[model samples]
Target: MIKITGEHHFAIDRTLFVFALDSEAGKVFNEKNKLVTGIGKVNAAMELTQEIQRNRPELIVNLGSAGSRSFGKGEVVCCTKFIQRDMDVRGLGFEKYETPLSGIPPVLEYGLLKEGLPQGICGTGDSFEMNHAETDYNIVDMEAYPLALIAMKKNIPFLCLKYISDDAGSEAAEDWAVQVHLASEAFNKILF
Candidate 1:
């Protein structure tokens, strides 16, 4: 029993999962409940708010691709924090990522997931690039951040399951898509 809407609408079954995006892709994972929109983070929050204003779920699981600085091929990571790495305020001699608002709970320090979980920093940016490397970062993406911010704002449980699609190197651009697919499969194993 898989329920899907847009990339966001999901239902709980034996294994609840969601693969949301600003655009439509693949076969209808679940057609009756799917939603399609280009509106992001803020708009997604509003949509989710209105939806939940009607019915709230227990948890939200986000699955997506991300660039990696330290993670190896086909690695899965549970984010402790989401960073907006592109928010550069260097022009003003300051540094910040312009986080939306915080309300989400902190990651469980020691839980069932900690036995062999990969620990790393997940950062967000509009573009996927290897040249823009940060020594402290391990992963990069465009969506998880706003999801984290919105989840924080709504005080909801959020888990980001990401697959490492690229390395912080020149070849990453051409290799990302294939790597993303490989990583997604690996992520499912770790998560399930």
Candidate 2:
């Protein structure tokens, strides 16, 4: 067993695993792993940064459930790109997802390729998505953008795998609750 001594006291190795908001999404890994959960973008960024600083993990893998209109429920997809859908600065002449003062681009891209996982673009916001026609992204989540951004800034390898739990429709929450367990199981299989 790997011994981890830090502020978090995690037993995980050099790789830090992360989840978001819901507990069901992390059910499998939470038993033996010290996984971080960010309820939203701000919380995610802060929590992930603190974990990275404390543990100095070489890589960070964020696994969670997501809503998608294109992907079928229970399908897991690796997010190659992340965008903040709630960061709207159109009045200041910046694009919808662009952060004005930040040097980072509106869309942060992860080039890592994982075998057997389909590639997708994840658009993240604070609110749960109920309409699929509002955005063009392949998946919708609440925390992936900040997690990806923090990982990029800290120069750590970041990989995001999201399980489709809903269709971003009126029944998304209900669907998500039912599919989260399956997502967690799928994530565990991929990681271990």
Candidate 3:
């Protein structure tokens, strides 16, 4: 009973426990069929919790693609902690996109680079980054934040499996499309 949620559907390598998201990127599926109305990352956690409350799963895995601020492509970094890098609250002079809490969760861990693949901490954002000049985070992506926040609210044990598709401050911008397949393939090899 593994359900997956992310922005893209075709990028995942294996489909054994997959629950494919639709165009708006939301759905519920068993091993046999799917049921999708209209949902996205913001509501995904509650949706999954409700679904799992009715029938609990062993665990939930949040799998997707991301942009790296400094790391190179083909790297498979796991997020020990993910901050909403786009959360704007600087009017009071507080740091924008600061971590919600002080310390990392004990359960929020990973076996990074276990397969001899490059891996590192993932810093999530709500935009596509083409360079790492201003941002000091390791990776950037849109959906991982909401997914992590929601999952935390539900007290669900989860893992973020991301592949670096774009390097924020390099020529990798043009190479993103060409490297996506390689990244996905790398993620598949490491995750499964």
Candidate 4:
């Protein structure tokens, strides 16, 4: 269910825009359809589920800051695939990223792709990635995997847009602190 469309054709009213923090989305969006779902996967899933129970949104859109090594700072990327970076079950005779008994694959490969944006395979986990080692995903974040799964289970449209706030390995914390606030400037151009 991946499709790409330009911002001019996007319907903001029917979309529920989600963020990990208010600071990430506060500058551009209002309270109408915005949801700030704390940080981790549990919080993201829980909050999004609660909101869905309250009112069914036509689309679930996740907009947040992410760390990337390949992409430059201030770049807005469209993430169509999500993987649980922390799910290590190799000790249990399962694959490294595979969930122990879950039917879902390691990567959740369904999302709405926005036009004119570079695509990314996002790795979602609880910890902020300072220097990510070997991994299949190019983008690192804390919430997108669960959000994409929830949207998939509910059969709602989902879109994930990430602003590159820091270089994953290179002085990430300091760079993220200075760059996270500027995320909205990049997102506003594409999403507003």
| Top candidate (lDDT) | 4
Candidate 2 structure quality by residue, lDDT tens digits, 28-100: 6655435656578888888887877777876677888899988999888988798888889999998878999
The worst-scoring run of ten residues by lDDT in candidate 3 lies at 11-20
**Among all windows of ten consecutive residues in candidate 4, which has the lowest summed lDDT?**
1-10
TM accuracy, model 2: 0.88
Sort by TM-score, best first.
Answer: 4, 2, 1, 3
How much does candidate 1 score in TM-score?
0.67
Model 4 segments beyond 4 Å from truth? 1-10
Task: Give Cα-based local distance difference scores for all models.
Answer: 0.54, 0.78, 0.49, 0.87
What digit string (tens of lDDT, one per residue) describes model 3 on residues 1-192? 222333223222222221213321122223222223123444554555565566543444555556776666666766645656555556755566654353443123332123344445555554566655544356776555555565566665555667676776567657665665464346445543
Q: Which stretches of candidate 2 lie over 4 Å from their true place?
A: 1-12, 25-27
User: Per-prediction TM-score, please?
Assistant: 0.67, 0.88, 0.61, 0.93
**lDDT of model 2 at residue 15?**
69
Which of the two, 2 or 3, has more TM-score?
2
User: Candidate 4 on 50-107: residue-level lDDT in tens?
Assistant: 9999988888889999999888999999998988999998987987778888888877
Error of 1 at 166 (Å): 1.5
Judged by lDDT against the true structure, how good is candidate 3? Answer: 0.49
Question: Candidate 4 has which clashing residue pairs, if any?
Answer: none
